[model samples]
Target chain A: MDFVLDYISVTTFWTVLFIVHALLAVALLGALTHQAVAVWGPVRLASTPGGSAPGFVTRFRSVFAPSYAGVVCLLWVLAFIFGAIIYTKYRIYVRIPIEQQGLFKTLGAFELKEHLVTIGLGLLPIYWYLWKNARNAVYDSSRKWLTIVLAAICWYGFLTGHVLNNVRGFGS
Target chain B: MSAAAQTQSAPSDRRRIFALVFGVSFAVLYVVCDMAALPMFTYHPGSDRIDLGFTPARPDEGPAMYWFGWIATSALGAFVLALGAALLPQKAGAKIPLALAWIVPIALVPVLIYSLKFYWRW
Candidate 1:
């Protein structure tokens, strides 16, 4: 940890790529969250006393809930590609040395991050299908679970990426 | 309930099954190849491991090939898996197997994490 500043130097190329990757991850995070909220809800005005109208924001998100699927899937893959590129440096330099230095907890967190991201990739198709057919009654239960799971994965992955990047700037 | 409607709907069913197979296969194969094939081919900077005939890419070189390998292997896997899954019965009740759609991906969380054992050394 103490050596982080001394050894980690962010090059322009890596920094630019990191920015692009982070932006994509953030966009993916927003899309997934918006979609999930649409699924799990917007404190329905109908559920409120006197049964008022839903907010404009809630109405708008719900309308586009089915659309987030493809964008999320695409961004998820792109972010992973960027991460993979950055990972080449992390694997040899940052990660190995961190493990060698015995920062087990930090390293373990990153391990979980990698696992979650890859697992998220696997989940995309089902997630896409569930959301695409969100209007259908048969897939109701599965769609709920899938959306919740994907959102959770995105949240975890986003936080983990940020934490790791802060610890040692992406491939610096 | 007309003949035209029946003809139209049949292809959608085929497409669904095809999508299921291709998607499942792509994800599974990508994970598998990432763990096995890509690592085998990527030349680690400092290592004494013998290359069994096939040359590995230099650790610092050619990231494109690694990415390419991932896409190509998964495409190959998807083609094969789609063909196999398509051959299965497409009866209404038979879609029970597509449950693997959500199941396998969820299951893979642990499997992918386990591969980190090589790195974690714990």
Candidate 2:
């Protein structure tokens, strides 16, 4: 442990964790995108139970929505955890430069992204339970709109984080 | 009703109400706490200090992070509301418009964005 510690530095550690964080965000992005699309787009639903969801778009929406629920929740949490850890790095490194440069809109966007992610985290349990059991009939529209909203939040968070990185990436 | 039927219905009702209560309460609480700056604690990154309750940074303390504390306050408040779901009547879930699960959050989006006006130059 002491030997490995000597071989590493703070920036190196943050960089590794940040890389994992980005990868998790990408995975989370993909999962949420698919689930959101399937919920909104025309597809074979569990209620209906049988049909060929051919074509590029149709097959994309054809996957079972429930399966994505648990995975999305899991990935959301994991990405959030990693992001939270790397956040200090962003604060100390990237954010000071951003703040100094007077990018208020960019800073504002990131601020809102934090709120969006927190809200999404709180909503996960309910979202998972709804999708887990009732993805149809009375709750069909509920599931659709809920998925869309969450997906939108996620997309915003991802894109904002991406843009911020472009402005002043880690270890800046 | 039969025992099995009663058992099944109870959980379904509980779940529905729990989801509604948690979803609506969390969304509203987060926004309210944020706009009001009612954080549970403040983290001053420069001074490396964690001050309980929402507080402005002292001189030379640098930018304080209240976002984490706001999240804490909202999550705590919303969890209490969700817990209260158990005391609700079985049919209570039906009374809560299901659309609120998404509607409240969507409505909050604009408000959340607007609250950042201080950060916006436009």
Off by over 4 Å in 1: A1-10, A42-63, B1-12, B25-40, B43-75, B87-89, B117-122
- DockQ (Cα-based) for each candidate: 0.22, 0.42
RMSD of each: 7.2, 4.8
Tens-digit per-residue lDDT, A21-125, candidate 1:
899999998988888887776444454667666667767566567777899899999998998777766666677666667877677777677656765675576
lDDT of 2 by residue, A1-172 (tens): 3465577987777777888988988988888888889878756445544755357887777777778898899989998998887775677677888888999899999988988888888888778877877623556677788889889999999999999988988766
Among all windows of 10 consecutive residues in model 1 chain A, the one with the lowest summed lDDT is A1-10
Which one wins on DockQ?
2
Share of reference contacts kept by candidate 2: 0.55
Q: In candidate 2 chain B, where is summed lDDT lowest over 10 consecutive residues?
A: B1-10
What DockQ does candidate 1 score? 0.22
The lDDT for every candidate, in the order shown, is: 0.67, 0.81
TM-score of chain A of 1: 0.80
B1-122, model 2: which lDDT tens digit per residue? 34443344324477667767887898899999988989999988777789999999788767788877887898889889887874677666557776888888888889988998988885
